[model samples]
Target: MAVALPGVVEELLSEMAAAVRESARIPDEHLLSLKFIFGASAVQALDLVDRHSVTLISSPSGRRAYQVLGSSGKTYTCLASCHYCSCPAFAFSVLRKSDSLLCKHLLAIYLSQVMGTCQELSVSDKQLTDILLMEKKQEAS
Candidate 1:
């Protein structure tokens, strides 16, 4: 079953889509900065850009989050507003070092947005809850 996207996720997607559509006008310096931070992952992210891999899941109370399923079949969560990702690279690198901005999963999301290839699917509240539980369990192990 399908559900409506939460306000925050919807807004974020709209903003990213607009930015992607207008990316041509973005400054070279900004592009260089992104390149510097994301490194080789920037190039790798492009290959993983697919609309079907990214989903927007929300709780019954309207809390929203993003899930990116990698080509490896692993799932990563991207939280709203903060841009934080639940990936090992994000935790070990981005969080440990302030210089970095994104993991491959997050980079893939950004690249997918810029390429106008991000597909958003809205899932049920129970699905969201189950995803969260699974994430927590994975972390614990």
Candidate 2:
């Protein structure tokens, strides 16, 4: 069987260009209008956050707080406010955009959903019971 040779750079470039054109529904002008602000350099960013996996830590009070990897200070924060991931990607998005529902820093939230880790898991038994009671009342209605 004969193997086809790799396409020439020109051919590859054309293919890439086509793919970009077809896949990129957003116009260059629109994309260019968005500034890319990042809190950390790419390398530093990688070290700080995990692309997958959400870890949960529980406080002594039995309040389970959630933690996803956050890129900051050349190391992962391990745990940060779910509302505010300390990763540079999050920082950049906050600085560059006014409304962002999800950024790379929100990977923890995604991971939590995927991994079925609840941010409220750390809540005290009384707190959890209260929540359950509230839910039950809502359901009964």
Candidate 3:
């Protein structure tokens, strides 16, 4: 059964705007979250905007699924059978009362999804490079 992505565009854009606003705030706490989420050495969370932007790409095999790691430092299960993500952020958000479309965890997975899987495409330099070039062009154009 296909999971209905209702109001996906509106939700994604709303989430994007919230992320941008949070990035502009540049709170110390937010920076820590970025480091925790992205595993980047950079202190500013703003640096993640680039990474986040590229996280919407298709996974290998053309699956719509994306990947992400939870704050627990474990790989999230991209269960196609279930519409929900496994990260605490997502789990908590969904199980709780909230209207968020993409929690930070989902966004993290989105970033991971666009970045491609290390297990599969890590060595496919040619394909990875091609994908990166495509992403660059898409962003530039």
Q: Each candidate: what lDDT?
A: 0.67, 0.40, 0.43
Top candidate when judged by lDDT against the true structure:
1
Which tens-of-lDDT digit does each residue in 1-141 have in candidate 3? Answer: 755444643344345446546663334554454455434322221333343422332445554433443444444444433456554555565567554444554444433333332223232445545654554465455
lDDT of 2 by residue, 1-141 (tens): 222322442243344345446773334432232223222332232232234335554544654434454443122222334344444555566446744433544434433343334343365667545544554465456
TM-score to native of every candidate shown: 0.67, 0.33, 0.36
Candidate whose TM-score is highest: 1
Candidate 1, 32-130: lDDT as tens digits = 655565677765665567435666676667877778887678888877446677888788887887656567777777556655567766678888888
Deviation from native of the Cα of residue 4 in model 3, angstroms = 2.9
Ranking 2 against 3 by lDDT, winner: 3
Which stretches of model 2 miss by more than 4 angstroms? 1-52, 62-64, 70-82, 117-141
lDDT of 1: 0.67
In candidate 3, which residue ranges exceed 4 Å CA deviation? Answer: 8-67, 111-141
Judged by whole-model lDDT over C-alpha atoms, candidate 2 comes out at 0.40
